[model samples]
Target: MDNNKRKLTEKELKRKNDFEKISSEMQQKGYKIKNMTINIQQANFLGPLSMLPFITLTFLFYHNVNGFDLGEISLGFVVAAILFIPLAILHELIHGVTWGFFAKNHFHSIEFGFIWSSFSPYCTCSEPLEKWQYLLGTAMPTLVLGGGTAVVSVMTNQLLLFILAEYMILSGGGDFLIILKSMLYRTDKQESVYCDHPYECGFVVFEK
Candidate 1:
């Protein structure tokens, strides 16, 4: 997905104002801060767009291997639609739980809420994290619920599981965007810290 892709329309420009309140301590500690947060448009557009290949690959694999049943696919779609809300909530929780585990205050540093305007729920971690820790938390939900279920679906030949995997993977579009940006970002400095943006779909980085 990396080699020939175009740059994202949303750039992580100097968004210091967004971090002033949350990053007071990091400021005191001499961390050079930068925002990696994405806008609503990027979250709504780029996130899912990045995940298209994964979704297509999964569907094509299943279709090629097992050949979907029309009735089964219809039932799976119905069930996925009915359960999406709770599952979406779970997706955010997985981020919280995984990040919280490595946070200095544990889960106390985590917050969850919904953006009524955007129809999106968020999980935020107030503490700064090691780079790898941030990556793990960011990727956990899609790995477990999305990829794991796809494997099980293949083994069981259950179209419902595959459909559920597709929907969950789709929900991770924003997450995939965040992770991809985080990886592509470069620096000569050897150390960095990551903190989830308190109110946005992306995060901020603190570096020396």
Candidate 2:
């Protein structure tokens, strides 16, 4: 830890304690912490791996639903691809906005920054939340931006929008991966709260 780093709040401290306890139990059960860290290499690999199925399904579904022709790449596709920068920012904003609502300090508890080495933008909530609230926040961008845009693309027969939506969904692979890990190892405890890791792309669970 850096000496100049901001001190954790009392709430954050308690959450950290709980997280450490859960981590100890998990380690005893053979879980490795390294497996949960979301670094640049993992993102590079998982992004495309997760996107293959998403792109294929979106293409097929839109084709079947609207009878839309899969057309050749055009200038419009290029434009949409360029728009991914703003879209990525919006995706992080969505996470901040949704998760901020559940935090005790609201937006003050939310931090948005980029990992320059990974070229990834992230929004993290410092406060702890119930498992369901955390899940909802994690899934909101995928559900709203990804799935919603894909639905609209199907309705409007826009290939570019479909591709864009698939890309957004793919960007969420890290979130889904963390959720999957939690589900696999989490105990059935009602007091469990999920806290987004301050310096990483995953979450830590704390149970009272």
lDDT top scorer: 1
lDDT: worst 10-residue window of model 2: 1-10
Q: Give the clashing residue pairs of candidate 1, or none.
A: none
Error of 1 at 138 (Å): 0.9
In candidate 1, what are the lDDT values of residues 1-208, reduced to their tens digit? 1213323222111223434555777778777787887876768888888889999999998888888899998999999999978898999999999999999899987877776565767787778899999989999999989998988898889999999999999888888889998989998876689987654567888988
Judge candidate 2 against the unseen true structure and give its global Cα lDDT, from 0 to 1. Answer: 0.72
* RMSD, one per candidate, in order: 6.9, 6.2
lDDT of 2 by residue, 2-95 (tens): 2145466555465456556656775676544433445646767875676677768877898788764435346446766788678889999999
Against the reference, the lDDT scores of all candidates come to 0.82, 0.72
In candidate 2, stretches whose alpha carbon ends up further than 4 angstroms from where it belongs are: 1-36, 68-72, 188-190
Candidate 1 TM-score, true structure as reference: 0.87
- Candidate 1 Cα errors over 4 Å, as ranges: 1-22
Best by TM-score: 1
